[model samples]
Target: MSIQEARAATEQYLPGLIAELKHQGLMQLEHAEPAQLCQLFRRSNAAGLLIPQQYGGLGASPRDTINVLRAVGSLCPSLAVMMTMHHHTIATIVQLGGIIPAAEDLLRSIANNQLLLASAFAEGKPGSPIFNSSLKASAVDGGFVLRGTKKPCTMSHDMDVIVAGVACTDTGGVDHQGFAVIFAEGANITREPFWKTPILRATDSNALIFNDVFVPDEMVLLAEGANAEEIEASAQEASISGLCWFQLMVGASYLGAASALVELLVCKRGVQDTHLAQLAIELEGAHQALLGTAGTLEQRQEADAGLYSQALCSRFSVQAAIERASNLAVELLGGMSFIESEQVSYLLAASRAIGFHPISRTAAAPTLADFLRNTGSTVDAPEPAHV
Candidate 1:
């Protein structure tokens, strides 16, 4: 099907999936095991959303993938994230070209419900140079020996493949040719899960350790000094367009969670005061802005080529959605919102965790600074009316 048709079909499937999730008690905001999450993906129809038709995926566009993720997120952000990372792995493999020895087979497995892949992009802490990434691979006679510990790898437990980056440690520092992107089968890897967080407990975003893993020459998606600029250019395009879709999904899920909280409010306490109503309107505006951005990105219209603007807008949406959703949930649900059983609490955790995901927050400074410098002046701002 065409991209547009695929996206529409995805949209049509969401409400039913949401209802099913609620019915199955998956929406109870509970922790799920890695195996269980993987099974959930297959059962929820999420596993086939992004793989190419030739390889077993739905062959959907980035837009369609985002829609599927948004639907999943609306029901369960943990599931949403797990699925997002899975598709991202596929997208990465496709981006690097499927010529790698087992790459095609991996994608086909995903298409055939035989494999799952997670992204191991973020390492160490959020922004530290050391934490940035120290993974390295050296050129060997027959193949490359990969070594490094990648932290915060999504879906590390059940994933069958990992698309990770390694910085070259040669005398030459962080040059374009100073990096290598490698794909490793999950069997050769080890992981330690991070479960202290309340949100996305099932995401299994954990640390991955690679000990002298041998990847055949054919398995190297990207090699040292191999047109580094070209790969980065592709990644930039993917980030501004493809990856942006995931961010949009994040916003949509936040909006849906808040919508559910609002429903619970209506059932419990009747109509809310005018202020809460106004807040609802504001939240709705943010949601509309998010969807509008998604539509614009999907079209790939030249007018939407403003990468800087799009990125900043996405950041603002995430922050605004998190704040609005949190405030509204607390205001509407009152003290009970803090309880784990409450939907608001789970939604709150999801929003917060997503807001801080390494990939999403890397632009905090630049995005905030750009938005701040481009805004209206204080002299022209409207004053608040007396309470």
Candidate 2:
């Protein structure tokens, strides 16, 4: 389906969201902290799109979720990126629903209140594992005390809750990799300016500092492992679902940005049919690849390394397609459009951000290679090669 069709589907799911976001004006949406766009998203109850109906969510399917993200990305890339973080965090929590205590209550609260959740799993350090947190948690009588920082935490300003990866030490001194849920109301939690990039300034991807923040025992989800490697192993398996959703949605988000540029070219008369066809083939091919992977994920009973690999493959492909499509669109749109308005340049730059997400092509190459070599073998999180 075309990007227009995707927007139509998104309208069906999140009615008037596109119009509301577009009404904010592109400059305002891109240059300022997306408070209004975020508010509009919450008002539309888009936060619950992935949550189950029982949890006060819309329970939208994977395809619908992808379409909505793509449409939103076309309008506001920052909002789409923020939504990816929120929805994937929701997806991960949902996967752990059977184990997390009072998860139902948490899900219901998020859905009903339209609360925004920000993920602080990425350390933003080269060669660092996204699942491994520099944030350390020391076991306490009732809970754990956390200390460290997570930079470039998207939606930092508007998030009601922050889910962060941490290195937790038990009373016995056994260290485990885990996730800690910290409320934004925590007195010890603070934020600093981190994202200086003008391109995605609206995302509010700032540095989140946890200064002796206390997290209740129930708020921490520790993997079933005693040490670093084992913890990573267990966490890796659990991460497949979240990673798959993240890559697919993020890829679609950037694809949507590229599609926006392509739309402009299509609107301009006298554009060559061959040039238009090339853009369509690249974009639509990537879109279908995402759809195919999403269909597979939906049919599966559970997530595995194999599906995660497929998702990554699709995401990387989409990344390439987005770059190519965006460049081609800009060239066809001519120099006047490029010099007169920031829209074309903005979309072109934003679409390129797909390459900056976690598990970069270089980081994932070794693991993917191993998986490709032995299809029966489980994919492992290899030490990322320095790029």
Question: What TM-score would every model get versus the actual structure?
Answer: 0.77, 0.92
Error of 1 at 208 (Å): 1.1
Q: Candidate 2 lDDT, tens digit per residue, 262-379? A: 9888889999889988998998999999988988988994689889889989998999899889988999899999999899889988998887888778778886887798875556
Worst 10 residues of 1 by lDDT: 1-10
Who wins the lDDT comparison? Answer: 2
TM-score, prediction 1 = 0.77
Residue-level lDDT of model 1, residues 231-332, one tens digit each, is 566544543443455456555555545555554555666555774566566555665566567667547622223543664466466567657756765676
With a 3 Å backbone cut-off (N, CA, C), the pairs that clash in candidate 2 are none
Task: Give per-residue lDDT, candidate 1, residue 356.
Answer: 61
